[model samples]
Target: MQPPTTITRVLVIGAGAMGSQIALTAALAGHTTIVQDIAQGRLDAAAAQLRESTDKMVKSGKLAEEQARRAHDRLEFSTDLEAVAAAADFVIEAATERLEIKKAIFARLGELAPPHAILATNSSTIGSSAVAGASGRPGQVCNLHFFNPVLVMECVEVVRHAGTSQATVDTTVELARSLGKTPVLINHEVPGFVANRLMGAVQKEALALLAGGVASMEDIDATARMALRHPMGPFELMDLVGLDVVDYIAQATYAATGNPADAPDESVAALVRAGKLGRKSGTGWYSYSR
Candidate 1:
């Protein structure tokens, strides 16, 4: 089958924050987009979040009211993976950051999606190479990692593994641009890709400083913002991205590399154990009233 030159139908598997935002981005770009999840409750939550996000955009004058309405109209939410995958021209697996879960989804997508469909993942840490083999279409599988708050983040990492085809990489880059994102191509697969790897280094140092009593989290964050000219300190950014997510990425990296230094910091693990999961949970390095 000839590689798909254009993406018209998009299937986003998993209706959490990242998945929902990705579906919305496709719909806003005028693609027929469906957000699929196993749980109806998660789909319901995703739909509500999409509505709230679009409304905020409209209110902020970033999106026209009519455009937002049309984008919403283009989006569909469902629990039927087979039906959606069967019809999708592009399938993006945005499930939890677990290798097993992603491999399972790709295995299914490999069986269900059209031959020309390009399967991608929104994983922040786990490289697509680890999951691509299960898809039975490694040439068409790549990582399309989007940052948190997908609508606002301009950078989308288009990562290609060794088996990924040039056509697939080009098509994925075009797709990212169509969604109004700036695509950064990573010719080789690496843990955390580009942005996250740099961010991870900063996070590790920040955690070490906090552990050593070199400074408070607030002071460290202040140093980053004031001295490094970063918008948010590493700790504050981790909170925004969700501490649980940070920990998960850390664990995934350590598992992939088997390096103790890559493991989740003790402080992060302790907070996650206590259910303090950052902004989503209303607390992490800092507390938020929710």
Candidate 2:
């Protein structure tokens, strides 16, 4: 356990959609962030997207051009994994949510990264302990589960495994604050942590209602928006989060609790199978012309 020191150089591995947003947040927080991806196109696209997001903030008068420039200055894109792993003070792995892929990254990272560097994963539902178990340095590992649209969201789930040290956990929470995110600590290793579990429950109920012909999708959405004052109903929210994510959560939840409630509703599986992968893929329960 090291003291709660400032994160000097942050490395974000895997410049996917979420990874890009995370790297932008870290860079805007004034830390040197190296964003890397296995594919050159992904790295380039993520870098471009980060620039666009920050530029929008600049145009909105939230940040001065010089500040934006400085923030962008802190972010560098690379296809080189070894370089980033060796130099980062803190590394956030945002690769695909597959366990095998994550394990492979951590195994390589365990060999490459400095001993003092803290490793974090952006996994929403996977057990931090399982991920850390493959890390080989579980004592220096923890979960830094950032909510999507990380550049705008303010909450992070700070999770620790059995072997995670108090120092590593504290340093991560402190870093979360520094990045302007509220950190919620989890005492036990639960799949989906806190947010995803609650969200999955709500959506599963919504799906059961739909499947039972209780109401049409529009009617349910209207009820949530008007009666509950929710920005979006279950289906809409599910679309925003991506069907793949919800499916992952449900599977993890059922595995963790052995509860039928956590089982994936047939409707969700159908949507994913149809390649209606939600907003990013252009459709889900809602139609997106773009």
Candidate 3:
């Protein structure tokens, strides 16, 4: 199937940090964006976050005041998924990282959204290949992996599954470009895509180093920042991304490939089990003043 010449109406499922930021970007790109989550509380929080993000961008001079205002104005938050999906020209699912959850969402989106609408997943590790069949429109289903703090991250991976059509990929690439992002096309689906896969190697080593008591977290982090010139160390980035998120990505990759190297570090599992999720939870690898 051919993609619509333009995707002007977008529905984003889930209104968490990543989802809200993605909706904001789409709105800023002049699309009428709807953000839907199951809970009214999440939708309300997402709305508040959207305002804060747009206001921050304007104040920081990253975005013009008028454009920021318009972007916020274009965003609509809702708890009614079916109603929002019906009107969308494109649907992006940024829900939980569970395969079953995503498949269920895709099934519902397939049944509710317009047949011509493009279905995309913003999964960091679990590729669309696993969920596209649930959409029953696999050719239109692809992965549009946007990094955290979506506004600041310029790279977006446009991943094509075996069934994803070239038209869908082209349209997704154009959509990413329209949002002022650099889109890298992944001709075939892979666990963790590209960026995360590379990061995974670093994270694995970081975990191994810590597990072996080679250095303290601070020392390792300083080495990465001061010597390697990385903006943040693996542990710091994990704290920001949330240890749970990092753990989930690692586990997903391990589950798909059955590679022991993809398994999350024991320390990460211990943290998650103890409810030290990360920045949002006030602690993970590091503590936060909440």
Model number with the top TM-score: 1
RMSD of each predicted structure:
1.3, 1.6, 1.5
lDDT against the true structure, per candidate, is 0.92, 0.86, 0.90
Residue-level lDDT tens digits of model 1 in 78-180? 9999888999999899998777899999999999999999999998887889888999989999999998889889999999999999999999999999999
lDDT of 3 by residue, 1-290 (tens): 57797999999999988999999999999999999999999999889888887788789888899998888889999999889999898898999888899999999999999888999999888889899999989999999999988988999999998989988988899999999899999987788899999888888888889888999888888899999999999899899988888888888889889987677788899999999998989999999999
Count steric clashes of candidate 2.
0
Backbone clashes in model 1 = 0
- Against the hidden true structure, what lDDT does model 2 obtain? 0.86
lDDT of 3: 0.90
Mark the regions of model 1 whose C-alpha exceeds 4 Å error after superposition. none
Better of 1 and 3 by lDDT: 1
The estimated TM-scores of all candidates read 0.96, 0.95, 0.95
How accurate locally is residue 105 in candidate 1, as Cα lDDT from 0 to 100?
A: 94
* Residue 62 local lDDT, model 2: 86
Query: Tens digit of lDDT per residue, candidate 2, span 1-290?
Result: 46337788999988888888998888888899999888999988887887888788889998889988998889899988898789888999999888888888888888888888898999887766777877678898888999988977889999888888998988999999989899999977887888887777778778878989999888888898899898889889999999988887787778778987668777888999999989989999998979
lDDT of 1: 0.92
